[model samples]
Target: MKLTSTASRKLAALSLDEIKEAQQEASRQFEEFKARGLSLNMARGKPCVEQLDLALGVLEALHARSEFANSNGDDCRNYGVWNGLPEMRAIFGELLGIPDDLIILGNNSSLQMMFDCISQGYTHGYSGCEPWCRQGDVKFLCPAPGYDRHFAVTEYFGIQMIPVPMLKTGPDMDLIERLVQDETVKGCWCVPKYSNPTGVTFSDETVRRFARLKPAAKDFRIMWDNAYCVHDLTDEPDQLLNIYEECLKHGTEDQVLIFASTSKISFPGAGVAALAASKRNIDDLKLRTTVQTIGSDKLNQLRHVLFLHDADGVRSLMKGHRRILEPKFHIVLDALEQELGGLGIARWSHPHGGYFVNLDVMNGCARQVVALCKEAGVVLTDAGATFPYGADPNDSNIRIAPSFPPEEELREAMELLCIAVRLAATEKLLYERAE
Candidate 1:
């Protein structure tokens, strides 16, 4: 699909009469959308049925008669392998660019591991440091338009969240460096590669800056969530600097804790999650986690190991994922281009990989747009959800998750989304005129 050039005049430039006409047309389309009674949702970044079906081998990888022991002869049927299966760790280590000894596997959710890390800081402290719960008014640096679940965890713990601007390259490093100077600032959340909603991969320089951070707090950490490290949608994928290596260079390897998983690559609920940090951090984490449970499901770990044998196997699997995801994303882009292109009221990112397309409609129009879509039987992730504390000062950003729906549904959803955006912008403009 050919995109319309931006050379045309913006919506804000049109005369009162032209704006009225546009508003009337948009309102008509919105009503027609409502009449269709289409229950479409583009809210969460869930893999499509076909993508999940590709990993059905994982279910059959193990059985009652299968080998219950790992290569090290550690019986997976009973207790032991406290950290994780050695071969599984090695595979994840290779995939995440970390040493196997520094990596530790958890159950299914990397987010849970992240919460535990923060909980550890709050409860027991890190490497014998003072517990954050005992500390006065601890704060966390949150890069705006970030993952909502990250914010949710911090909020649940009652940690103050400070919003820092996020750019196409990465978070604003200058501000981050300045903010960490406060002793009360305990940590920062990061989604380095193919980040949550905007899909902004941190540039080499940004990562290097993160590594060299000189914080006032002894336990300042960078929660590096590399959830989409291998979820590339193109052959020549965007490269991300290795945070662990960069931290090693700066002699601050303990300052970063990397999190990753096979959630999108395979089944979401049954996938494996892992954390890679400094030996000291890993030791501290293990000491705290020892009280939680005996060990993670080694049987499930064995299944993942058998299904996706190595880094090469994971890469090949991701290529299959791209074939399904790339077109869905394209449908969204095409619809946006054909409908709202050349209209200065909106702008969106064209990510090479990641599950979402970040759309920034006209300021103050996002919530109205979302409401309009919902009223028309289409649901979107609420406006300002990407920001810390559910606030977007300008209320512009909207994360579009195109992966869950089928191709035709995605096309229709995008069409409705575009119409909602236009209608909201039109309404806002008319109201401004009246005022």
Candidate 2:
């Protein structure tokens, strides 16, 4: 039968013979894919080669003839600017919508800075508060289908993770509000703009609610990891509510620590990362962070500032990125639509901008689908990697990172993925029918 996109028909709606035929066709395609011995990967959200080439000039931005002093004449080659170069902070300050005084630059990984925040809370706590480790049974709110690294950090710290439902607007605020009422719920991880995997930015109401949350712990923090703040796939992308600004309005500015990086914007390994928070939080972070190192790589910060120039420069660079990325994303979306659009067995996110496309297959079928893809020589991010402890209770959500591969390789991998989704879904329906 010819497929139509007008409406979806569930696999359960098909007769046994029809389901068997569909499964056979999908199995045949899977075997053909396997025979090709394709070694394609869509597992990590890495920038493609073209994207990496865009920042080659960042290396040239600084040279032997260039002065190594920051705007304040502080020698970037030497140690001392424990926070960061003044000009670099100014650039991110404007971009992140926080004041210059509130931003603190770190090494390439914001994930490292996040880990430090949790470590400090565990050992020293935030600003005179008792250490979290000393406290009994600490908990954190984890919005599922989130950045797996975020979940991994919380898990490594031995913090109990509470799963919260992520809605199209954002995580369920009603549930988050209720969970944070307990003092043990010390913090929550947030990717406010073009969230990892799901690519759903928080709504204005959701950001405001997050800011106004009356958490029982004074030291409670909202780890706002806005990694994709400017990674817009379209000219007019989703508008993210400024959580730091909203936090200030609610008199809870210290409650959220905002993070951003130039990883995808430029070189991932050599990019600069920054954290923004209230003065109190900044000072507290400085006190703990200073002992760890004399300072971050100010020369690298200078390289970025000199290259990116300012916020508009960052935006311009991202426009180039969108040019390279947008088409690749469309390839995946189009392949999914053509192959599985009218099959009620699968659905996926059509994000305006982000590094990933979140795909949700029929319940109890994601693992099987991923295994099938693997057997066909196409690797995917494991089915449940989006949730805390790598467990998606429904076992349905799969994070598709389409940024790493070339367009043609990506299209091939995605087509194989759709076939696997169909085969696994059909097998599931048939199994249920037999039962």
Candidate 3:
């Protein structure tokens, strides 16, 4: 039946016949399904196998003749360059849309740069300020439903996490501005473009407010991890408001620390990453990182430069990735629509880009749904993995990573996923009604 505007609760609930019919349609698939003996994962943000194929050439790039030498004519084969070589820094700066001077070339993983920054702040200090490890208490504002690794880093440091609500435009800016005013709040983590799980981009206003934050601690910084800067799956890309430029416009360029990685672009294990920020922040970051090494691999930098001359090369490559991922994405989306379009028990995002699709199930049923999927041999990201400390107060957010699986696998996975979702949601509803 069609739902009328301003309908009452009783009218909104589907009739018993509709529910039974829907269940039967779903049951036929489950009853007819056979054990495919497949052990698949749709849990992590890792790139798809076909997408990963794009970087296979990087192995040759690494072994190529002339690209292995740095600015000083040194061999990258040796152990050195902890902050990364210059050519690599240039590649990262170009990739992330920042000036090379402001970008610090990090090793293979961008997560390490973030982790190292936090570790340094806790110990040595940021830009001549008092070390956070020396402070009695330090707090971080975590944009809820964000990257798990970021939260994991902060949690490992015993830093207190204050959850900030996320919206379509970005994290609730009003709440962020107010909280930052407190002296104890020192930092916040943000994946500005195509944010993990939610795929929400930060609006111009949100970026502006973030740049202008008047934190009580002079050392407070915005951890801007733009991991999906070039990963647009749709033909029409979702343009993001550059937070670094917003900072410059707001006259607070010193407040943002941005990072990007080529891990997803090339090889996750051997890719180069970089950190972009104000010169002041760079100088400070160098103080800690400088002692860590001599220079990053100029060879990989040269390899990427030789391979992908400019941003266009990156875009051209992503087009290839989009081809592989877009169809798989639609497969999951269609299955969700087919199985749960108006059930009033679940909702999910159809993001134009990014590696994830966020599904919010009936309140308190997400963990149960994830458990059900696991029993059927499909591995999913932990139900609460999107939130800080792996705890979702509502237990409703479920991140669906579609990039890793093939279309056929995704279709089957999503079909099974719908059953799991419905079973868990129904049980929760009945149990709650009983209570």
Model 1 off-target regions past 4 Å?
Answer: 1-7
lDDT tens readout by residue for model 3, 1-435 = 322121233212655554444445444544444355557798897787788888667667656375466677766767776566666666667666678788888777889999988898888777578889888789999998999999999999999999999999999998988898887788999999889979998888787888778888887878999989888999788888777777887778887889888888887877778899898888888877778876666566667766666677778888988888889888888988777776677789878798889899988989988887887778999988888889999999999998888788888889888877766765555455459
**By TM-score, how accurate is candidate 3?**
0.92
* Model 2, residue 12: C-alpha shift (Å): 2.5
Residue-level lDDT of model 2, residues 301-329, one tens digit each, is 98888898999999999999999999999
> CA lDDT of 171 in candidate 2?
96
**Model 3 bad stretches (over 4 Å):** 1-12, 15-38, 62-67, 70-83
Tens-digit lDDT track of model 1 for 96-183 = 8899999999999999999999999999887578999999799999998999999999999999999989998899999999999999
User: What does the lDDT read for residue 93 in candidate 2?
Assistant: 92
List the lowest-lDDT window of 10 residues for candidate 1: 1-10
lDDT of 2: 0.90
